[model samples]
Target: MTADDHALALALADAAGAAIRPFFRGAWSEERKADRSFVTEADRAAEAAMRALIEAHRPADGIIGEEYGTRNEGAGRQWVLDPIDGTTSFIAGRAIFGTLIALVQDGWPVLGVIDQPIAQERWVGRIGEGTTFNGRPAATRPLKDLSDAVLGTTTPHQFAGDDVDAFMGVARAVAESKIIYGGDCYNYGLVASGHIDCVIEAGLKLHDFAALVPVVEGAGGMMSDWMGNPLDAGSDGRVIALGDPARLDDILDAMS
Candidate 1:
């Protein structure tokens, strides 16, 4: 991947972010989904706007999005987008939410960009091109064990008590642990940058992962499901990612 791919990925995410900005402070009625997740007027509008932008810019490429779903899935090059990753937080007046856009070539993420409009921070990365938060390069810290790591996850509060207990077993063994609630795609950026050691989640879709995969991989980390499989569209609901592979196994083992 080169500067051009990174540029295009960033531009796409930025366009999507702009589309979601208007609904930030505006009043929007909420609606519940089958899974109990909330969706607002902004979610649908942003996703539609993002799909149009991707179709216009990457004419031949396929597109996948959270709200709009996918049009073409078998294309060699596809653009996956999540217009507002943390919709609940977005509607709750929190700025921790952002847009996730990624370019996947031949089933692998080639470029990724997470645009946090509220924080005025944009993370751009390309496979083998390294990763950057804003304009500065970012890389994870060298903590080799979960025992000394400060782990961050999307949400542990909502998990089943038994599942929470299972995870907390791993957490209690760690030096520190915290939930970056409503972090969405931002937590992956955090793990890649070394501010957080890990970002575990139980439920996710393709649009949920597209943008973060490369950013984490570019920063010399690994992104995979809890069962030690690659994160494809059909990935298990659980995900485990770490900069240090050895420590990752430790975390996974503790969970098991």
Candidate 2:
């Protein structure tokens, strides 16, 4: 992606953040979806705002969003968006929720942005360019051993059937005291910022994981599914992120 593409990604994130900020901590109506996920007017408004901006600025680019479905499916350039990634947290009035924006060219992610409107913090990343927190460079902290690594997940309940057993096997391999929970997308950002060492979770959708690839990789981390495959639109929902590339095989082994 070009420098302008990176800027456009950030602008889309900013627009979504602006649309959602007004509803934060304020009274808003919400309803549960068939998948048991929550959605609110804030989510719709933010996504609509982003879609309008993209339509106006990049008319040819396709769009995929959480609140709304896909559009212009075969366009070579597509933007993936999750206007309010952690709606459960957002409704609970927690600032850990954020907006996710990614630009996928030819089915490969090339740029990403994770923006926390309440905290006023954003991470922008692109292929070949290191990630930046706010405006300064950001990179992960390297840890070679699982015993010393800090681990995180949004919720253990997300795992079901065989996934629970597989996830626990990997969890037990790490220090029990170091396993933290409930950060949603914030945990991934923390991994990129070097504040966390690893994040593993299951049952994520394309919109949930697509925007995260470039941000984590750009910050010198490795992100993939449990089978050690690189994540893409067609990847399985299971995911593992290692801040230190050297730990990839070990973590994958533990999951296996």
Candidate of highest lDDT: 2
lDDT of 2 by residue, 176-223 (tens): 999999988888899999999999999898788888888899999989
Best by TM-score: 2
List candidate 2 stretches off by more than 4 Å. Answer: none
**RMSD of candidate 2 to the true fold?**
0.9
TM-score for all models, in order of appearance: 0.89, 0.98
lDDT of 1 by residue, 104-198 (tens): 88777778888887787887778778888888988877776667776677677656756787668777777653444557777788878888777
The deviation in Å at residue 120 for candidate 2 is: 0.8
Q: Which ten contiguous residues of candidate 1 have the minimum total lDDT?
A: 175-184
TM-score of 1: 0.89
Clashing pairs in 1: none
